[model samples]
Target: MTIAAYTLAAVLNVFILFIGVRFLLQPFAAAAGYGVPATQDRAYLEIKGVRDTTFGVVGLVLLIFAGAQAEAWYMLAVALAPIGDTFIVLRHGGSKAVAFGVHLATAAVVLISSALLFLA
Candidate 1:
């Protein structure tokens, strides 16, 4: 259980880092995958990139140095981002499928990861 929790946490962080990089390098594509289309203003996309990258780094740092309890708390807090994203997509004229399937699903996984870390 411990190993599984740590591994999942690490993998999730790495995946988040990848997503951040993708958002930075390919804003339009990333926004499309995020269940939204990017407008001419790319600043918000860059902000999202930075936010996700920072989150990924924080999660990794907590897991590697701060241990499971800290990582658990971080995960619990960070889960709110995706939960909010679920609504953002919905309110932004994005599809319910993407809003629920992607954002909500991610929130669920993050919460589960937090629970596992807490147990560990």
Candidate 2:
């Protein structure tokens, strides 16, 4: 249980880091993949990149230094970002399939990771 929890958390953090980098490097492509096609505003995409990168780093820092309980709390709180994303995608004329399949599924995985960390 402990191993699974830690591994999953680490993988999630790394994945988020990759996503952040993607957003920073290829904002338009990242936005399309995020279930919302971005317009002319470059700032928003850059902000999202920063936000995700920070989240990934923070999660890793918490897990490494603060331990499982702290990581669990962090995961629980951070899950809201994805949940909010689910709605954002839906409301912004994004595809329902992408909105639910990607963002909602991500939220569920984050929540499950939180629960696992809690149990660990």
Candidate 3:
């Protein structure tokens, strides 16, 4: 359980870091994969990239320096991003499948990681 908890948290953090880099380097494609197409304005996309990148680094820092309890709390709080994203996708006329399957599912997984970290 301990190993699983740490591993999941680490993997999620790294994956989000990768996603953030993708958003920074390929905003259009990243937005498309995020269940929303990008417009000509790149500001919002860049903001999202920075936000996600910060979150990923924060999560990793919490896990490494602050330990599982801190990481758990961080995970619990960060889950809101995906929950908001679920609505963002839905409201933006993105596919319902992507809205629920991607965003909502991510929220669920993050919540589960929080629970596991708490237990650990």
Candidate 4:
């Protein structure tokens, strides 16, 4: 249980880190893949980077500093972010595949992490 919880947490942390970096380095690519493109605007790009990076680091901190129980709550709440991301992508001219594949999958992973943390 401990291994599962920690593994899930680590994977989420890394996944979020990748997202943040992608958003920063490939803003247009990331936005387009996210289902909404910012029209010649840098602000949204930076915002995306900030948002993803914050989520990643916060989740990491929760796991490392607060322990499994707090991380469980964090995962449960943070699941909503990806659920919303799913809708955002689906509603904003994003493909069904990306919406379900990426965002929904992420939500599921978060939920599973919550369950594992609970068990731990």
Candidate 5:
């Protein structure tokens, strides 16, 4: 059993749960962090909230239900998603801070998770 892998999986799962809660409870703030302002349309806000929450929950489930190695692979695959998100935010007039702070940060964390998984 690799210590780093287990540690990474556990930490990542907890963080994902936190992210899911943030999306659900503070949708606007979460959206702002995601480099997007809340839209006037409720549907769009709901979409973001639901999507983020789902991702978080699914990530957590991968760790809990699957295993550290599996979660690691999941993290690796999902890294591309945030990379894409960074560009999307930038292309859509999002500020640098939001793009880097949220999306880039997420990608880094995911990469770290992947490394840990690999070490495991």
Candidate 6:
């Protein structure tokens, strides 16, 4: 359980970091994958990239320096991003499948990670 908890948290953090980088480097593609299309203004896409990057770094820092409980709390709080994303996609004329399948599923996984971290 301990190993699984830590591994999951680490993997999630790294994966999010990768996503952040993808958003920064390939905003259009990233946005498409995120269940939304990029508009003319790239500002928001860049902001999302930075936000996700910061979150990934923070999660990794919490797990490494602050321990499982802190990581658990962080995970619990960060889950809100995906929850909000679900709505964002839905409201933006994105497909329901992507909205729920991607964003909601991510929220569920993040929540599960939080629960596992708490148990750890």
- lDDT (Cα atoms) of all candidates against the true structure: 0.92, 0.93, 0.94, 0.88, 0.76, 0.93
TM-score of each: 0.97, 0.98, 0.98, 0.92, 0.80, 0.97
- Per-residue lDDT tens digits for candidate 1, residues 3-116, read 999998999898888889888999889999999898766888988998999999999999999999999999999999999999999999998999999999989999999999
**Which candidate leads the pack in lDDT?**
3
Off by over 4 Å in 6: none
Steric collisions counted per model: 0, 0, 0, 0, 0, 0
Tens-place lDDT digits, model 3, residues 41-117? 78889889999999999999999999999999999999999999999999999999999999999999999999999
Worst 10 residues of 2 by lDDT: 38-47
Model 1 TM-score relative to the real fold: 0.97
Clashes of 6: 0
Clashing pairs in 5: none
Model 2 stretches with alpha carbons more than 4 Å out: none
What value does the lDDT take at residue 10 in candidate 2? 95
What RMSD does each model have against the real structure? 0.7, 0.7, 0.6, 1.4, 2.2, 0.7
Which lDDT tens digits does candidate 6 get at residues 53-93?
99999999999999999999999999999999999999999
Tens-place lDDT digits, model 4, residues 1-120? 799899989899878878888999988887887767766787788787888899889989988899999999989998998999899888888888989998999899899999999899
Candidate 3 residue 52 Cα shift, in angstroms, is 0.4
Candidate number that wins on TM-score, 4 or 6 = 6
Higher-lDDT candidate among 3 and 4? Answer: 3
In model 6, what lDDT does residue 20 have?
A: 89
Model 5: lDDT equals 0.76
Model 4 residue 25 CA deviation (Å) reads 2.0
* CA displacement after TM-score superposition, residue 26 of candidate 2 (Å): 0.7
